[model samples]
Target: MSRWKPHVAINVRNLEQSVKFYQNLFGVEPVRVRRGYAKFDVELPPLNFALNEHPYSEVGALNHLGLQVSSTEEVLAAKRRLQEAGLATFDDMNTTCCYALQDKIWVTDPNGIRWEVFVVLDQEDDRVPDKQKILVEQPAVACCTACEKHSPLANE
Candidate 1:
């Protein structure tokens, strides 16, 4: 519990549906659940994932959410596991995304939020050397924005 874990709280249309989706995705039951809310303290990825039940119809222009893994094998493994769990997955192998070469798999939550488990193949990618400049020029969402739009689950 020493290292910082990323906390993501996304609004969902139905708490129960989201809870079931996450349970299959993370392979763990939410540590806490209540009316209009649910929380899964994912251990393997060290994420504080939460869902808020609301009448939130607009998903906003969120580019996506992701888990950065260490290798292509790991990415493939995730694809296999998720697919086996009856979740459809999309693969983007050796693509230059977020200005870096990466291998990743994409999945859409019941709420239409795109999630990716990716591995950066080229950390020193010269696409955007000035990290701060990239941040200033490109809308943060632009990084992987196209990735989600082109995903098979884009409509889902």
Candidate 2:
């Protein structure tokens, strides 16, 4: 049997800033990192969450939900099991998402929410993405236009 953990992906305006914020909030460092992406695996309550850099005008905070399995075999098994139950499964294999190579299967719920069962590949990618090159996106709505650095939410 394979272990399963909850996976949550959220969109953020700035990846570098958000990563720092989440690190302080969770008191843990992200296990995975790539250009504009970071994955935090928390052991306290057992959660696998990721932050993705995206435009605020694109969508809401939540990107999707999923179960993080141990291996590709488990992912394929989940795919078959899901399909056997008559749910349409979409395969996304050898894809570099959230900064890692992954094999995942997606299924949409009745409410149009998507869920995936995925496994991160052990293959190593040597090309490290330069963090300084990431472009920051602005908030969709006008916010904190005139706030001080330490008083409220502002550049510190």
Candidate 3:
């Protein structure tokens, strides 16, 4: 078993601009940069942070937060724990998302914040297509009924 790290994914208006900003803030360049995405594997603070370029009007600047586990088993264990606790979970196995092949589970907090538990299986050269990206982005609105029921914003 390996250590888990806090992962934050932010939606940016421009990839290049956001990348430069993060580079200055973190004082290190991104570990991976793709067509519409960039990742920073920061060690001092232990963060697996990423920037995703998207239309600001469609989705706000903040994307999703996550825990990057070392293995798929860890992800499944998290899914089971969440399910047992009566929380809704969405599982994506070997999905090519965010320019990586990953096994992940998504759970929304009572406040409607989405948390992803995932392990990277492999990396891909090309960026995720818009159609597929949309499906991944809207899991709360599209799948998580529990989130909607508890979300204050969902009502208004």
Candidate with top lDDT is 1
Residue range 16-65, candidate 2, lDDT tens digits? 86676556444488999899899999884488989888765533433455
**Pairs with backbone N, CA or C atoms under 3 Å apart (clashes), candidate 1:** none
Angstrom error of the Cα, residue 95, model 3: value is 0.6
Give the clashing residue pairs of candidate 3, or none.
Answer: none
Each prediction's Cα lDDT score?
0.80, 0.63, 0.66
Local error of candidate 3 at residue 57 (angstroms): 17
Q: Report the poorest 10 consecutive residues by lDDT, candidate 3.
A: 138-147
**C-alpha-based local distance difference test score of model 2:** 0.63
State the lDDT at 15 in candidate 1.
Answer: 88
Which candidate do you rate higher for TM-score, 2 or 3? 3
Order the candidate numbers by TM-score, best to worst: 1, 3, 2
Residue range 87-119, candidate 3, lDDT tens digits:
668777776666566788776543234667779
Candidate 1 local lDDT, 1-156, one digit each (tens): 679998988899888888987887777999999999999999889989989998865778676888888889989988888888889888888776666778998888887888898998864434655763433233355466656665545576
Model 1: runs farther than 4 Å from truth?
125-142, 150-156
Comparing 1 with 2 on lDDT, the higher-scoring candidate is 1
Clashes, model 2:
0
> What's the true lDDT of residue 152 in model 1?
47
